[model samples]
Target: MSARAGSFSFDRKDLSRFLFDLYDYEPKLLRKLISARPYVCPFEDIERHIPEDAKVLDVGCGNGALLAILLASGRVKVAVGCDVHEGALASARMAAERTGNAGHVSFLKIRGFEELPADSFDVVTMVDVLHHVPEGDRVKAVEEAIKRVAAGGIFLFKDMVEAPFWRRLAHNVDDLIFSGEWVRQVKTAKVEAQVKAAGFELFESLEIPRIFYGNTLRVFRRL
Candidate 1:
């Protein structure tokens, strides 16, 4: 997938350059950040789904990298990002400013899903976030996320699914050591049920292939 900035098409090299320029980080550090855990999805896969002139809301948007990318593409009219982490919001604000798309995007520090408005965005995205939510609250959280999508808008959900025994063991161990929370692998069926319960119909579903992560990508359309 390629992003159009005015007339120029942005490739993977352009994405890397843009990120580096936005963060002003050393090349080695930037490489590590890009290749590290929790940021494994390729930009191309996400970019492909973004429509021109879209208004996007990214829930749990750490560092606003994805929002920055959408804004830089010149395809998004408005990009709103929210995260609970103050550090993440600070980084997101800095990145948006450096990318020169600060006017097109806004970052908010939110405590929970209740702070977001309903029917406000053409595209609502949650990347690697659902699994991190407490299992008992997952349904309510997803329902709240769906409410942010405008009529006929899309909700894009991406998260890791259960893996084979060895991979699952390694993933659980990594989560415990690095994130300090036990990773709850929610079944895709349960997620689908939640979305359906929220009055959204399944639009598309696919497996996003990534090393060290078994990810599922689903797109649901609000009726």
Candidate 2:
């Protein structure tokens, strides 16, 4: 059978539970999923506005590296990371503790977008998580993510876009690595336009280079 044909479908909750056991079973794979390199370029354009010790949410928060970076920078007052993968949350907590930042973070295993409150956060961010959302729910996912932000608050979106060179190359490499989780090649271009249609005014869309394809750092205002 083809790898894609056999891949399992994980909603927010299932993905979270799977994450708790991720490293013990697949340490290297988990590491790649949580790395910072893929994000360095795009995130550079947007600034984290949560006050020094402010409330922040990391959606599809992988292992919470972005939150950790914000915490370490002394910019965030409190940060909550939510993911469908418990392993990702566990890894984030472990990482926070290792950095002497224990208790400053928490993770929620959401069944879906409904698990979160509306207008409860000062800022919401998603890095490399957009592509993982189930195809049908992506629009609702982004719309809900925007609602989680307080009025006048910002949404920081960073993800990959298809360019001739990087799309094929990165997708191939990712397919080789995780196989199942790599974004299905079909939806690349449509995602950003959808984000705009979902009501997010594009703040910026910067291309990061062959480090990856058209790297996008979209800042959306929740006004």
Q: Which structure among the candidates has the greatest TM-score?
A: 1
Candidate 2: tens digits of C-alpha lDDT, residues 1-223? 0111123222323233333333233366565454424333333343334455667888887666566555444556667888878877777777555434556667788878768654477778876676666677887787778778776677777666555755646754764566466554435346567666766666655655535455556676665
Stretches of candidate 2 exceeding 4 Å from the true structure: 1-43, 46-52, 185-200, 210-213
User: How many clashes in each structure?
Assistant: 0, 13
Candidate 1 off by > 4 Å: 1-4, 7-14, 25-31, 35-39
Of the candidates shown, which would achieve the greatest lDDT relative to the real structure? 1
If scored against the real structure, what TM-score would every candidate get? 0.86, 0.72
